[model samples]
Target: MTATAAFEAWAAQHHIDAPHIAIKQTQHAGTGLFAKQAIVTHTEPLLRIPNDMLITTKNATHLHLTEEFRNTIYQLFDGTDEMHLEGKNERLFLKLFLVHERFVHANDSFWKPYMDVLPSLAFFQENHVLFKNYAEHLAGTTLSVSISAKQRALQNELATLQEKACGWLDQITLEQWFWADATFWSRVVSLDEENEAVDNGQATHLALVPFFDFANHSLTPNVRWQRDSQDNSFLLMPFEDATIGAHDELFISYGAKSNQELLFLHGFTLSNNPEPLRLRLPVTPFLAGPSQPAISRFLQQNAMEPFVAFGYSHDSAPSSSSQVLPDFPIAHQLFASTGFTYPSIVLMYLLALDEDDGLRIDEQENIVLGNKQVDAMDGVAEYTSQLEHFKVIQLRVILLLLDALTYHHGELSQSIPETTHPSALTNHIAAYRLEEKHSFECAIDALALLREELLQEPVVIQYMSSQEQQ
Candidate 1:
């Protein structure tokens, strides 16, 4: 099928209910899931991982077929089964969960190169049992057919994808790398019956969804939640007083991200020689439905509260058995300085149907919509005021980020003497006349994007070298 026809057919088949895929000519970002009438933060469910498809393992490896692994895959599919010969089974097993273009057009190894840079994946393979990236995301990872099998007519294009997927697994397996606390660890589960675990000790495969793929990482953002003792169905709406632009990306502290993963992706170099300074905060905002008194009193006292999420252990000990999302007091201290915070939740939604779709929210309750429960899709009326509250909190966070800067000139500047070299820091004197300029610029950019107002903002340079100005 032609690309347009294919995309439309796939959309229709998968349940893309929009009138058509809206393409933006200017923005580098590919197709975006558009908003019909200012979609506000109702915390409506979007995409999700199926529990049954989850193959939670202690570690993922790619060593050449070990005797134990071979036995397992053989027993699972009996290994020699001709079904592995490729055909619909291969596509259904692996590619079905990936975006149609990459799945059909790329090799399995094709994804490995892409996966190669993922700190979380690297950390998991090398360090932990398993890690995930983007519980919901686009074609971040791909699954290809084992090329030795039957050749599809689209081999040159899609076959390459298949090849890449395999190559990716091989290298990671060979190196035994792993990533701990980044979004790379958590994957949205795709339900494909044909894709079963091969006895050969390969990392269990996962699926990725497109729209829910917009999540970006941050040390902080507005919004918070925790499971209430009485209310199992955690409805995460924005704070009543928060402000949001028409098109801002609503991110709150739903989950804790790994510092190792953060270091890898954002280029933050953690000091092995010196530990992060410990911080203490007297007050923290309790989540909406506080089961514990500790979090409750903190929230009650703090005017603006920002909660925390626990990243995985760097030591690689057996992951904390208790699944309870814990708070990081240090993170809260940073936010308490700003006056915006409330209790919130890190919710996990799922795909209930086989088709692609979104839901409409009538009441403040969960109803099955589309293939998953998209949090942003529930009409804005229910949470507009709260979202605005979130926006105000976000502004305060941005200001805090600005306060962390060292500006010397009208331009922006950032120089971490430890992570950066003397030369790099020296070079920036021309750009920033005042110490605060650099931090303010970064915070501005960071906050603008979070508020979904990236379009109107001027280009704020967080780190500009002296030579670049010439």
Candidate 2:
């Protein structure tokens, strides 16, 4: 039987069925489910897979492997407090289980049909960032940076897993592990918390659901999946408002994910993906600013825990922060007013404020200026008499954004490969970068408007005139 036919037969044997949907090959996404006939929104589920059939870390342990091998797998899977750390241990266990089933057990394995249909190791080597071949195409993009880090992480973890191995795991090659990593990352879904009772002692948070994994992703998905707690199965059904027509491809939203995430994890990029542009401010050291010592101290004090005005130290800080930027009501106001990322807005404050700026970190670690500790909930004057002071902050922010966005756009432009016959991967990299470029342009345009508004302020005009005379 063909791979698809065998896969369907396997699903049927496990009691998975979707009469209204059939698997079909497509120009993109390889194989996806399509509507066999017009299907309306209904109370009945389109497809269901019993909880027992889910290929989870909980279920894989029962496989007929050597006692030593099974013990090793158990130790590795249960040893980490970091199991929740991006599901690393869980995925590693699943990857090893998959390799063992496909190679060691081969045709005798219960999951042989599913294994036959899993994408080959060669497919991931050519397409995924986990492999070195695809990294060059992603150079100068955030995903490229992530690709480097992810490869390092995988190698480190793979080494650790191998160190803990016995028997069959010794036979698994690095190439097989990489392929299994790709398979798990692309296909695994987090089981719903509501279905916790139905896990049947598997107690695993992640699962690779049979047949349900075939539906491709869409931003405006026609279908949604949920754990049918009462039925002890995972259900795929049309959304209440959706009207799926005959022959139309079925789609389920992967989640509201960014292009970088989609490309890194799933090996595909969407055109005009609506995920917000992630703008991370590059950390520049505060070497000689008038408030450098004070700012540096504040950053150091709260470096371990996030809070407004603290947490981002001078030497090295992440491109983003979860803290609220304290006082300077104008700075706080600009954050909501300008939809800029919180870290960027906070960085603008650091650049604009000085020792003489009257902003001080009080004994309580609350940022206060002139005896007023402003917060998101507190009331303060609508406008300050220090208009010239606030104008400086706004102008500095405008210049910083313009320069950063322009430089980033230039880097992206230069890194794009100059080829007329671009492959799908190249196109995906180009489109992903294109969305970031567009976001940069949009921010630049908004900065211009902000600059124009700043010029209109009387205090700003007087300040500029005074500086010009100097």
Candidate 3:
């Protein structure tokens, strides 16, 4: 049968109601679901996919296969080769392998119709250069680290799988496995809490819901989904009082994700994602010398660690109406938001002592030894007197961050061309890089504003002693 005929047969076998929606190709978004008629607000489910029809790790465990095949699959699933697969989940990899196997021998497979409808490997391969440049340009950012780590893990898994497959590796290439991985990451949805399988609690239980996967993402989605308790099926419903006009494509929210995350996972970026840009700062520099033990103890006491994150929203897309002042108190606020309290703690330490004194613990009480003058004052008074010093340190930190942002912005700005001939893949990569470049530029601008704002603060005027006034 033709691919469409196979899909229609599969939908018919599952009793998919076809009157409400139909799958169609869009000029830009590939294949997506469009409304056949006006879907009323708060209407009943547009689609209900039964549990048995869902492809999941739980289902994979029970698939009928030869003893050798099952054992190898289990070994891969268990992740016994820990050296290569550290900190990676094996279930998704194993499930994809089985799906690939089934697709190869389609005569005996149950999911041929669904498998046939999946986009080809070429669709994902076209963006290789973009992903490569993204990794290179965003070298130190969290998003870059995450992408690199995942790529490494995928490479290791494919190597191991290929080795174990013995002569069968000819059937599925590493590229095919990558395509499956991308498909799973982009389209799979977690099972509802009420429908979660027991063994899959630690790992999120996911399934590929056939027609539901076609709904493109929107920041402001008009539709929501839930599990039907009665039949153990997934039910796609409209968000409260939101109506879908006739011929309007259905859209669902993928949660409040950052542009980096959207681009990495879904191959697209939102032009106006409201999440603030965050910069991760290592705490190792602050923990050198005698301060290490004291810093460690302080972090232990406060339930924190050696890394801290600082972030700011650009005025153009402020995460909130209230602006965050770049001041001494902002460090405390940063501590509260991220568990990285080292910045505020280090500032206090610097304030209580002269630079020559260094950080030393008192023999009597494990307290940080400092200039006896500040130590004589009460806690609040001591901190208040150090405001100017703290402001100076804060300025230094902001400048360092701005320099890093400027470096990334420069790298990205130089990588893409001035223009490109319009093709689907080139257009997509252009849009993705544009969003990334814009985010970097916005962050640089925000940091420059913060620097200016900090320089204007009255505390920047060094405090003068009576002797100095002579």
Choose the strongest candidate by TM-score: 2
Among all candidates shown, the one with the greatest lDDT:
2
Per-candidate RMSD, Å:
23.8, 7.3, 6.8
Residues 331-446, model 1: lDDT tens digits: 22222222122122111111111112232332334333433333332221123223323333333334333332212112222322232332221222221112123223333343
Clashing pairs in 2: 308-324
Worst 10 residues of 1 by lDDT: 138-147
Model 2 error, position 318 (Å): 26
lDDT (10s digit) by residue, model 2, range 1-470: 79988888888887886677788887867689898888865777888887778877565443344455466666775654322423446655677767777777777777888888777777777667678876767776655766676677767777777786655666777677777777876777778542122211243477888788888888888888887768668888888888888999988887766676687777788765655544453434332444455445555654511222112111111222222232334445543323364544655555555445556666655555555653422211222224346776667667766676677667877887675667777677777777656555555655677778788888778877987999
lDDT of candidate 3 over 174-279, digit per residue (tens):
5666666777767766674432222323535556677788888886777777887798777788777677899988888776565555666776656566654444
lDDT of each: 0.28, 0.64, 0.57
Tell me which residue pairs clash in candidate 3. none
- TM-score leaderboard ranking: 2, 3, 1
lDDT of 1 at 276: 18
lDDT score, candidate 3, position 158: 74
